[model samples]
Target: MFSPHGPSLRELAVQALSSVERGYDLLAPKFDHTPFRTPRSVLTATTEALAELGPFSKGLDVCCGTGAGMSVLRPRCPELITGVDFSAGMLAQARAAHPDATWVRADVRALPFAGHFDLAVTFGALGHFLPAERPALFAGVYRALRPGGLFAFPLGAPPPPTSVPYWAAVGFDLAMRVRNAVWRPPFVMYYRTTPLAALRDDLAAAGFTTTAPALPALGRRRDGSPRCRLVLARKPADPR
Candidate 1:
């Protein structure tokens, strides 16, 4: 699932044993060559979806590795765009790619902003947080957004139990759990933790109304469910 320029098996193995920040730091140079980077098509579809609700001023991307989300945020956010991540190496790459955009190094669970952004988006970074960690993550996003501002991200539907992809995901998560149990500097990434219902409930508790719109460009599953949906959570215009 990696390009010719992607990290070697030795590099990936070493990374898996390192702390999350260190691991990503090592992977940063070759990140775009791996499947781990958000796809351009996904970014384009997200940009189209967010366009319908915005002419936003400032945009923030949480866990913005290598500035993929910055591309999506740029056309929609006329004023300013910022990306935040914990890995200094990743931030370095992002700064180089989108020099004009602000790049901050911060843990997303404690995002350092208050009512600052008109729009926020995160891509493929949720698996890094455990279920217990999601509340704080959502709360930070809520605090970061301006009143009536939006927080949007696309989530893929779980593969069916009978499918090979489904089993692969299970195996990956299982392996991760086993690794974390016996390893130092635990790398926390799990595929099965963030269900739609749980995310909606967390967003609501964080004082945002949530909606999930099918991303048609991503296509549908065999059972006809959307393969992916963009979860749009909006902070209320009037504070309660």
Candidate 2:
């Protein structure tokens, strides 16, 4: 699934054995060439979906790897744009790619900002946090946004039970469980952890009023549901 310029098998092995931060550090140089980077189609769809909700003043991209989300924020957020991630290597690549935008290297679970952004977005990065870890991360995002700010992300509808993607997600989670059982540092990515119900619950727990708007550009599933949706979590305009 990786391009020829992406990490080699040995390189991937080394990364998998390292902690999440170090692994991304090892992969940062060629990260854009890898399948691990969010696809352009997804990015474009997200940008389009978010454009309708514009003109946000300041934006934050949580766990923005290699700065792919900058395109989504730059057009919409006129005042400023910033990216945050735990990986120093990824931040370096992002800073190089979008030197004008701000980049912060800090764990998202304990985000440093407090009510500083008008809008926040994260893409393809939720799988990196465990279910128990989600509350902290979501709370941090909540604390980072001003009242009335929006936090958005694209979430795929779960695949049908008979679908190949369904089985693939199952297999991947099982393999990760086995790997973590024997491995130290425990790379935390999982394919099935952030299902819609769980996400809605977590967002509510974080005091966000949530909505799921279908991303029309992403098309429909065989069952006629939108294949994916952009989850819009808004901090209340009046927190009183």
Candidate 3:
């Protein structure tokens, strides 16, 4: 669902036919008006969670599209904030919107900084990365953080088999697979592929101790399970 300011069907069609980067570039101007932007509820919950764990210094927002995550980072880290993304168009919008924060155009997997930030956060970007690519991405985040620093993001509970949302995600993944099979410069975005166990293991292997905290603001499932959780990964104080 999109707001009145969101991209039109033709705009979305053009984006779907383009490469992921180019598609995002075309979509950047209207991205905040779409449901694709991380919800404010999740943002608030994450901001509060970070506040409880922090008073951090510098913060980095990986794949920070339109700078939504930077807003969450600013209060927790008073010193400085930086947003990095591969999309120049997104970075351009972010830079214009939040002139106070530094914006860098760089791939998350090959992030160009080491031990520079006290805190880092990413929102709604992991699904774009395949399971195997997670290690390199997590490692880059690890390298970007200072000793005793943290990297955090919120993840939702998997949709139940009987739910419409579950089938919707499955169908979307299937369609994407077919599209990638036929298209060049594949646009990789799959919601059902990444799991919590695999993600935690990858973060751990990348040398960060991890934890998942339930976000009460998102409410709970029928089984009394948290509907969403904030994943916090810490780069240890002693690197060795």
* TM-score for all models, in order of appearance: 0.98, 0.98, 0.98
The weakest ten consecutive residues by lDDT in model 3 span 12-21
Residues 138-192, model 1: lDDT tens digits: 9999999999999999999988899999999999999999999999999998999
lDDT of 3 by residue, 1-240 (tens): 989999999999888878878989999999999999999999999998888897699999999999999879989989999999988889989998999999999889899999999999999999989898899899999999999999999999999999999999999999999989998878989998778999999999999999998999889999999999999999999989
lDDT score for candidate 3 against the true structure: 0.93
Error of 2 at 70 (Å): 0.2
**Model 3 lDDT, residue 218, Cα:** 89
Q: What value of lDDT does candidate 1 attain over all alpha carbons?
A: 0.94
Clashing pairs in 2: none
Query: In the order shown, what is each candidate's alpha-carbon RMSD?
Result: 0.7, 0.9, 0.8
lDDT at 226, model 1 = 96
Over all chains combined, what TM-score does candidate 3 have? Answer: 0.98
